[model samples]
Target: MKTYYIKNALRVLLGLFMTVAGIGHLTFQREEFLAQVPRWLPTDPAFMDFVVLSSGIVEITLGLLMIILVKHQAKVGLALAVFYILIFPGNISQYVNEIDAFGLDTDRKRLIRLFFQPVLILWALWSTGGWKYFLSKVKK
Candidate 1:
């Protein structure tokens, strides 16, 4: 029971974090996030803006679902983990291109930041039992 509560708390915290990040994507930190967009992508500013905005919307939705859809948390967690995976390239781009944003000013810092992506993915899965859910499905 204690473990369950702890997981719930962590899930809620992750949701809040993602919500704020999504807001940052849409608002205050928009420019900072723009730096993370892979340079290989089209340079058209409008298209880039669309990518950021759409991803922000997806983040917001996933965050809210992670919080409110407790009964479906496993699915929500899976979705959020997938989302984290999807955005991993952005983090990679930030590191590879040596683009500074969110205080990852140095190459080492950006490189270290890359490792946290897997942690976030694990956190999402573990907090909502998505890891077990997925494993069970795979075993069947």
Candidate 2:
């Protein structure tokens, strides 16, 4: 019972984090987000802005769903994990290109930041029971 409460608390925290990040993408941190966009992507500023805007919308939606969809938490968790995976390339690009943003100015800092992505993935899965749900299916 205690564990359940802990997980719920963590999930709520993650939801809040996502919500803030989404707002940042849409507002004050827009340029910072653009810095993370893979350089290989088209350099047109308008297109890049579009990508940021659309992704921010998705992030806000997912964050709200994660908080409000208790009965569907596992599904939302899975989708959030997938979303993390999809956005991972931007992290990779940031590290590889040494694009500084959000205080990840040094190579060591950028490398360290890379490790947090997996933690976020695991957090999304574990906090919402997605890991247990997957294991149960695998055993069948």
lDDT of 2 by residue, 28-95 (tens): 99999998888889989999899888889889988988899999999888889999999998999999
Model 1 over residues 64-135: C-alpha lDDT tens digits? 999999999999999999999988998999988899999999999999999999999999999999999999
RMSD from true fold, candidate 2? 1.3
TM-score of each: 0.97, 0.95
The TM-score of candidate 2 is 0.95
Angstrom error of the Cα, residue 93, model 2: value is 0.5
Best by TM-score: 1
What Cα-based lDDT does every candidate model obtain? 0.93, 0.91
Task: Quote model 1's TM-score.
Answer: 0.97
**Cα displacement (Å) at residue 108, model 1:** 0.8
